[model samples]
Target chain A: MTLILEYPNTQLKECLIEELQLQCTSWRFAVEANNLSPWNRIPEECANYIKDYMTGKGYQFDLDRVSNEAEIYARSVELKGDGKDAWIFDVDETLLSNLPYYAEHGHGLEIFDCMKFDEWVENGIAPAIKSSLKLYEEVLSLGFKVILLTGRSERHRNITTYNLIKVGFHDWDKLILRNPEDLKKTATLYKSQKRDEMIEEGYRILGNSGDQWSDLLGSSISDRSFKLPNPMYYIP
Target chain B: MTLILEYPNTQLKECLIEELQLQCTSWRFAVEANNLSPWNRIPEECANYIKDYMTGKGYQFDLDRVSNEAEIYARSVELKGDGKDAWIFDVDETLLSNLPYYAEHGHGLEIFDCMKFDEWVENGIAPAIKSSLKLYEEVLSLGFKVILLTGRSERHRNITTYNLIKVGFHDWDKLILRNPEDLKKTATLYKSQKRDEMIEEGYRILGNSGDQWSDLLGSSISDRSFKLPNPMYYIP
Candidate 1:
């Protein structure tokens, strides 16, 4: 350890970079585990790391693994044929890919502008997350009704629907979004309340999937809620 | 991508190995997220990865990061000063480091023998995880009560206590272990019941920290639960 402290200038520089990488890796773990919630943006130092992570194969691989497990869980469940067996899916990062927008704008906390995001939504060009699309298709084939619960506002309903369909997400039983009055409520409370209404209507929530913990956490959550990784941001 | 498939033999072998590593990394993400629950062992291909992760700086760095966040969370709360603010910790990987045994035995599915594990526990030489130890001390200084909860059977109580005290863990208000009849229940149910009893007695659980999901999940879990990464094993 003493010898390392005596390292040459070049080695010291290398050590600093490595230290930064390790710190970022740890932050990623905490972010994914929900230990660091109520966070809006990734640490500024981790901007490049987050960009590489989202653009590189790691993000897709993580999604693929989670989706595979979701399929396994779906297969394990003997779905009731009563048409009340529901699978909850969160929109933005869960079913739709906002990667292009995040990619172009960068993740340095500057790109999260509300107006800019709304403009992206209006474009209706968000792609479908391939792994999620596969799970959506499989769960539907297995007789589970898909309920798309999103934090997006009701004003974006037309664009969200068009984009979802254009990007290969279709035949979902319901696309529930926030109403005008839900603007004051948190995503967790809003989604939870929506789920409660669904349960009251006799739907047995078998599986819920989302990139944000708020979507899968809180009251009325399903027994098998799968949290997909989103190291870029956190939603309570 | 197509050109890579036509690479020479040596390059093709490297490609295959890289693919295997990617698969293992994906598995690690799933394991950490608790998406792949009811799992007993890591994937065969991931054994080396797990060994490297647990032994290298990654594991310690993760612990350090989580512990630092735990401290931040602890400092955020103004203590009730009624001795009711309790911090829950799981015994095995949360407080003690079983690294020596896991390292020597090799995590190759063969090291999980019941008798072998019991023998290790009897030694009472397990060291305290430095990161956790720091948090343990800091929380105590911050006036939070430490409650050690474990799934270890009652038979290992004396040695467990010895190991903890020897490793500088003392003044803990309580150490909860499974009873003879509690063996029939899962760790989730058992720990939840204990927390419920604690609540009945007026303790408000402020934080829960564990390496296993079961330690922090279930009915009576805290809102500020920290899941320290343990890619080694999953105990439901």
Candidate 2:
């Protein structure tokens, strides 16, 4: 079972580690034997804690394919015609599921290990949610404009776009990544303003779907807004 | 000839009085001349300023009509059914032209004198703008709802509603007057929040037409936003 607690911060992380050392025999033995202290330098220990927490809970920690498929289907409705209005999708957990990698790494800070991620993308090993991928293909076939909007910093733009193409997201109009300076500010306000600016340039926002509130709240133009389930973790 | 200038504030009163005294030779002066200085003191001068401004700008201004029949005619569009989205009109320039009363009394800080306004409504003296009033009636007859959303305070709701009814605006869901407290905040945020709350309750806003930016900016739910001409004066 995968535990789906709201992702807590460093303070909670320390407490969880201390509690696990005192309780579960398996956890205590594994920690001492491996010299694993998530609270200390070992990042792998933290990943283990997350995995154990999930097993302690009742969930299977499966990636939600149904909801992701529904979103892509709904979004494809706008892409069916000459495609005057375009769709801009987020990357992580949206177009591609990153939970498995995160689960293995134990530390999100290390999840962005570009070399490993690039290799994964090159191999097309990162599985696409079948329904969502089908919907994306439908959108392209219908000729609606498609763009990718990601919170990933601009430095990752080239690799991200290349990876997306390699993974079958083709014929995109643009791939937008965050400016480094903008990432320092509240993420929500930054995305909203960018969306609004796009709308003002005459792109009708038929729909906006994202896991975080910041992605949708700033744009005044969206005809509809959808929130995807993000039970595994949260950013803000 | 009527000599209308922008509504005179205290500082502008002396200059306005001088200009009016020199230019308005055709119409006999009705108000007490001694009270004309410090513009706020002379309600009659203020009224004249509004009237002359309208005339100079080629916008027909009427005072006696309780309803803007002409405006209603020009603005009405047909909807699908008898069920209609109503327009909540503000009384001052939106429905009835208040220039005659303003011209006679000047602009004063006194609360709106509804008894006097009631007499005008009862008289039905103001002729409607043929196009606008026709639009209003067309909208009304087509089963679109007509609402009166005004900046008038709560104290004036009864009289305002009565006056609207007296002027042939008999059917409406509600007359929303601004709360006195709402006047203290940023008009944009206050109006937007209120409109959003109303929309949350399931009202589909087809369009919102108003002369002030405050009125139009307050509601984000409307399908379309229209700004009426307000060339003669301004509120802020």
Candidate 3:
């Protein structure tokens, strides 16, 4: 009878692990789908799971797949010779990955610290996400005027430009940063306003790529938007 | 040296599996995010993976999590007592599980068959996704008018109604279906047009839940939309 009870106990142990994993998978699905929009922090139970996702092949694979899909969409577009067709790309997770910084910050387990994150950004040592860089080059080759639209403050322009250039990003038609006046705006509104201004100026946004839903949503959203996975932190 | 070579060979075998699994994970992420929209059928290589996903704890976990999140969002909305506030629920995978039929099929490994699917739908024996049924009840209790918006045509109305009723769904304000004229329209356009009509009628769409991006997208997309996971199939 004791051995029988032990057998079930062993199964129970395995069940607990499976349950945690399933829960995190569900959490990630919600996060990626923007169902859990404006989420503040990773759940304590999901910490290790999210850490594994960020540090393991999962992160690289997700990035590769998004870039691959974006490339497919980019290739499908019939580019006009007019050169007014534009591709909007978000700066942070979409192009220059902040993994180096996040690696030190518990892979979203820790609450985000803006001052510390800003310091990391100022360092401008972020590396290019390999697949996204490839897609960037492909988009440029496809005759889409590249637009680097970021929520980074205007003060970060010089270092951001240097960082992007050092990481093989170049020849962007415009790198729009947030002005001090735009500080109060949500990233979604800020991006939409910029895109709106671009549309008013006759720049047709063919594709918009970003890790945040805010970057892809709102008025003047592109013809097609590709969302890259970012389980790290929500920016609402 | 031979032993070391054998060790590396074992590691290589593990790596191959890891690669395949990672690819499938990436594929699922893209699918959920709608980056791989209008995908026809599941990849042949992902057949076993997707089958496991659909049949195992993953599917149930996903359903429960989506319903849980939907419940949270539903509870958040302070619906007007006037009964003009509404919630949109997609039928097929949203409230009813086609797992009975899908179990016979290869869990999306096979190409979607309209005739066979129609026959299955006629049976009206589909089970309720328990979590979604609970969500359906919660939405009803929350003082919001429930709208059943589905891609299912008018032909399937009676059977669909029977299936939903058999599964414990009740008190829906409307069950909008596609007419023969609506057949040419994509699910997105058809659903959007319906939602637009409702909007014009002064109905406030507070929440929308669906397993397909088409259900939640387009012009009049709700105040908040929740996406349930359905890696089994993609509908444009």
Q: List where candidate 1 sits over 4 angstroms from the true fold.
A: A1-14, A108-111, B1-17
Off by over 4 Å in 2: A1-83, A106-126, B1-236
Estimate, for each residue in B1-236, the C-alpha lDDT of model 1 and write its tens digit: 66766677768799888777767767777777778858766777788878987888878889998899999999998889999999999988899988888887665444477798889999999999999999999999999999999999998999999999999998899999999999989999999999999999999999999998899888777859999988887888
lDDT (Cα atoms) of all candidates against the true structure: 0.87, 0.50, 0.91
The DockQ figures for the candidates are 0.61, 0.01, 0.68
Q: Model 1's A-chain: what TM-score?
A: 0.94
Candidates 1 and 2 compared: the better one by DockQ is 1
lDDT of 2 by residue, B124-232 (tens): 4544334345546665666667666776667766666665656555666667766878766654566676677667765566655555445654446455444444433
Best by DockQ: 3
- Candidate 2: deviation at residue B77, Å? 46
Residue A213 alpha-carbon offset, candidate 2, angstroms: 2.6
Report each candidate's C-alpha RMSD, comma-separated, in the order given. Answer: 3.7, 29.3, 2.4
Tens digits of lDDT, candidate 3, A1-236: 99998998999999998889888988898899988857778898998998899889998899888888889999999988697899999999999999989889888888889999999999999999999999999999989999999999999999999999999999999999999999999998999999999999999999999999999988898988999999988887
> Residue B213 in candidate 3 has what lDDT?
93
lDDT of 2 by residue, A52-159 (tens): 533332112112332343345454463435445766666765666665665665534253465775555445345454444565666556565666677777876666
Candidate 1 residue A192 C-alpha distance from true site, Å: 1.6
Comparing 1 with 3 on DockQ, the higher-scoring candidate is: 3
User: Just chain B of model 3: what TM-score?
Assistant: 0.95
For candidate 3, give the lDDT of residue B58: 85
